[model samples]
Target: MISKYPQLFEFIEALLPDNFSQSQVGMSGATTNPRLVAQAVLESPHQWSDYLTSLSGRLTEAERARRLYDQVIVEGARQLHPLWISSRRTLGWLSAQIEGGEDMDERALVARGLQLARLAPNVMIKVPGSEQGYRAIEQLVAKGCSINNTFCFSVSQAAACLKAIHDGRLRAQLQGVSTERARYVISFMIGRLGAQEEFARQASQRRLCLTAADRRWAEILVYQAIQALLRRRPTPARLLLCSLKIDTDVQGREHCWHLQRTGADCTLYTLTPQIIEFLIRSQQQGRPVVPANGWVQVPKRVLNRLMAIPYFNQAYFEGDLAPADFASQPAFITASNDAREGTQRLSAFVQQTGDGAARPVIPPASDAPMEHWS
Candidate 1:
């Protein structure tokens, strides 16, 4: 498949394990979120039993959850550190996401990001793509921290983050701080974008004839437009495509639409283990046809029908949304809420664990040279 569909290899595989050895399978990087962490905690409670027991009982459930989240990311990064060093920091990055919720302010995000950065050099902190998130991203990057702008759905969000990253890199350079190892990425939740119902509602109101094909191409057009926009200027941040979903054609052949359509693009794709399995199993049928150009040309009729919808219009155009409009998008809101729920569930689960094994208390994270903010 690597020889046939080389584009599939250009991914920063998601869902990291404590002992990550999938690098041999063409995984260059990994990412995790509250949902992924919660899944991990549930899947391998025994692997973390001793570590969880070491956490102080005095800590709140929320605090314990955060600690567990960070520990998992740190362990993954540590395991990948050898590969990172061997590759001279070109690969083997693990993205550790901070707490996600509407209530996460800039100050708290920056503080959490700083803590995560100090845990591992190869860790890239994942920040939300809201207005405050962009501010935190800029501040953290200026302090020599790697960043991954996540929960992003529109071109405007990606553009804002690119500017933030560029400005932050400039500030870091001026401060004589080295960001050579600090890679940056902007994630496009393509699957979530497609799943949003706002487009259909808007089309209904406008009396536009929307079809399944139009719905499918909505995010693909947006992603291609963002890719073109990003390439128009040089910036340190790379565009990452995530939240990929699979679909079956009329002939009943399974396909990951985004990968089949634009997997050849020179951008990072973050695939979960399930998606990876789908790709591996898909090989049994034979090599799927992938387009030579990652930038897909939307059909004229499909574009005409989709342009009638306000959500589609906003998503397809770069300037339709301001930085302030990012959080209100249905896709962002749903994803953020899901993350919050995941975190809450994880905290409750941690509190309910019956493991009574007492172990040596894990010492608190050592303080790095603290940056005094006036």
Candidate 2:
């Protein structure tokens, strides 16, 4: 099915090799985070027990944790090394995230991004889309590092990141640095945008009863608007749509609207395990998929009601939210908080279990595979 759409690239959002292999038959790459790293360790302790034990007792807990985090990320990169080489670095990118915070300093983000990029050639640093984050992204890209701009939900944020990527690429070119393999992606968190709490609260406050379908259009429209914006000014970056939801219509037919309503060339979809399996099942059931050129026309009535919610309005329009206001947005706040918690959990696991030569006992294997930390 994916072959029918040459422009649509699928990446599995996972780390461990088994899941990577199972879901990656047609996947171009994978993504990792502190949370996913920790989950990977917890699920398959044997994979990291030796490395954990090898960490010198002289190192502090935080130092050990950081090393362990990098180790996991590097391992993930190694897992996809074959694909990276096979694709000539055009595919098989593993997005590794730095410590996330809305107010994180640009210098620190850039430093961490450089450190992650040094781990592997295909490690795409996951930078935030905050005000400072834009600077960090530019500097990293200028240094010839591939970047995956995360936590982006609005048109303004996407535009800002796109410009930053372009400037960075231009700077790299001017400096005679090779950026032939340095790819840039701006992620639009579709599910997070639609499921943000503030959107629901605002809708209720306005006495508007929005159905699931109505809420789904919020991110879809924003994505389309961003697509239109990108088409006007082509750049070296592609849009990666993540955090997508699978919904059922009134007729009980299942659909992942992000794929159903998807358009544009050079668009990437980073699918969770559930979404990948759902697609496989849907394909087996012979469910019809919309073509890559398909467009969804959002009704004016639905659009008007959606615009009534300031959160939706801010996300749907390009100039509604400034870069300075990005950190204050509900979607940004939620994603940042979630990322912080994920990092904390991984850190806690390292601190609590890093004592002495006592090998942490691996838990009994479960039927289910690990899910994303978010």
Candidate 3:
């Protein structure tokens, strides 16, 4: 059947696995985390078991899990490799994160980043948006490695990511490296903001009544501001919108409509398989949704109200918000908690795979020297 919403399929085609050749959407990249990996294993045990069995006799439990994780990610990169080639190295990459560590130092982050980047040419090292992550982003970018700065909950964090990318590009230029092949993405977790808002409302016993769409708009405005800041850069990195939750048809329609209205360049929307299916169904049943000819305009009143809030200002304007500040934010706190739990689950999975394995092997530290950008 022909797609009613070709643009939506175009976007999906850009991000899906290589075998999905229905459309030629130019998705810049896709990302996978520990939770996502675990989910895939659970949902497709037969497919994953063969891969897991191959590594059973050769590695420790943790090592086996890590390798499987990398294997899956590399496969994804392979699927998206065509886009990378077609974009002239500007897009079509997959991201793999450094597992098991919550607070890695800059050096450690870089070491892990380099290790993950080595898995595939199209694999982007996914880093958390901690201060150390920012430093690692700069270092990796300088070395001409693609980086995806993940867990960015606030606008300040997003700005920090952009600054790091800019600095790294400059350093790459100095080191005689061609940055035309380098790409970076700052991801904003969309659905989590509404969850956070709800959490905050319940804990404080204050009813700051706002719909999920309202909360999402506030988050989008922050992204829009970041996009404005990036316009100043000679070669700006892409913005990725992730963690979209579609609970109802209306919500799904709204999400699709908003994406259609957003006319930003090099922007990517990463959807779960369920959401992608939902969009496909929506398009088949509903009328065609066309891409907006212009950028979606945020109401000045809404923007002003969001800017006036202290937390919002601190997050979007200061670019120096502390980790503690993020702890108080519902969305960030929830994500952190979820990540820890996900790690524990992976560890359990590793343990279940018995002790009949080879000796533990530690991945080598990256010896790449840090280049300074003046």
Candidate 4:
């Protein structure tokens, strides 16, 4: 099956939320460039059909499948933001169907995504976070489209998403497309979210810490995005949370807490069916959603401090996390993750300051170093 559609499969694989995902994998190839994207769209009719045929040897056109999806309620709601990516696992048949023509897979998929955009204000057309996808995402945004900047692994991808939103909007406005409806998001997968497992592990070896602060880098982008949206506010482009893989020991609340603190009307979470079900399961299991005062507030100052926490630091949660867990990941084994043992190396940094755990408690100050403002 993999060999049958190597390019398509790889393209889709990059889209799927994974245990370990990288931005490089997300933005690779036709997924990034515009010309490449147009080519994929033109060819999707046939390739999409081929992909579907591979699945059952008798699937209908992509349009039919999408129409069937219309009433399904698929994975909405939890997916606060809509994604517009072409996936091998899910949307792989796009290429073949597009190539097939009159069969109407390409038009159907694009139209369907566009049509569905109306239903959800937070629609985010997820491309492979690549050139082709990025191009498409940019275009969609100009068409008053919303985007889910998929395939993000590193800060670079985030930066790229921001630029694409701007470029896509400019192109649309220059061409007079009334891109006022255009919007975009920078989706950074949360759990199992690190670029590599080695990153998580190396932080452990270095006694580097992990904190909501580490994840806060995204907040800065989000805040900046919020500001940009306010100034230009092209359909309110935003920063979103996607690919949320949970770490049982971490006990963090990615969105619930974030929404509370940031009150970020612009953000949303695109949780997969699996992730949605998992969160449901966790909630049913009697896990507390918010610990203090029954709710968590996400003030900008808090977010700012949280963002200051550098990446790959495991020391932040060394006390919270078992060393074995860190040792098991590739980053830990390779000892190559660039973990930042926060400026405040004191153990006191643990337990407080953006600890995302459901019921996180700050450690006694006497036990650790005082958290610094710088």
lDDT of 2 by residue, 137-254 (tens): 9889889999999989899998999889889888999999888888888888888888877888899999999788888888889999888888888887888888867887789989
lDDT of 1 at 152: 91
Candidate order by lDDT, decreasing, is 2, 1, 3, 4
**lDDT value, residue 3 of candidate 4:** 49
Q: In model 2, state the lDDT of residue 321.
A: 94
What is candidate 1's CA lDDT for residue 310? 81
- Please provide, for model 1 over 1-374, each residue's C-alpha lDDT reduced to its tens digit, 9 standing for 90 to 100: 34544544433232222334434345677787776666666666677665777878888767777788888888778877876787788777888888763568889999988998888888889899998999998899899899989899888888889888888888999999988878888888888886877877888898876666676788888888888878887887787888877787799878776777775457777766556656656654566434346456678988888877889877788879877888999999989987786687567666665345322222223211110000
Question: Where's the lowest-lDDT run of ten residues in candidate 4?
Answer: 91-100
Count of backbone clashes for each model? 0, 0, 0, 68
Please list all clashing residue pairs in model 3, or write none if there are none: none
Best by lDDT: 2
Q: Write the per-residue lDDT of candidate 3 for residues 338-365, one digit (tens) a residue.
A: 6665555555555554433322222123
Model 1 misplaced regions, further than 4 Å: 1-25, 289-291, 354-374
- Runs in model 4 lying further than 4 Å from the true structure: 1-124, 131-136, 139-145, 204-235, 245-265, 272-374
TM-score of each: 0.86, 0.87, 0.78, 0.39
**Predicted candidate 4 versus true structure: per-residue lDDT over 218-324, tens digit per residue:** 43343344334434534345555543443333546333333234323444444343443443444445553331222233466544443344443222222222322
Q: How many backbone clashes are present in model 1? A: 0
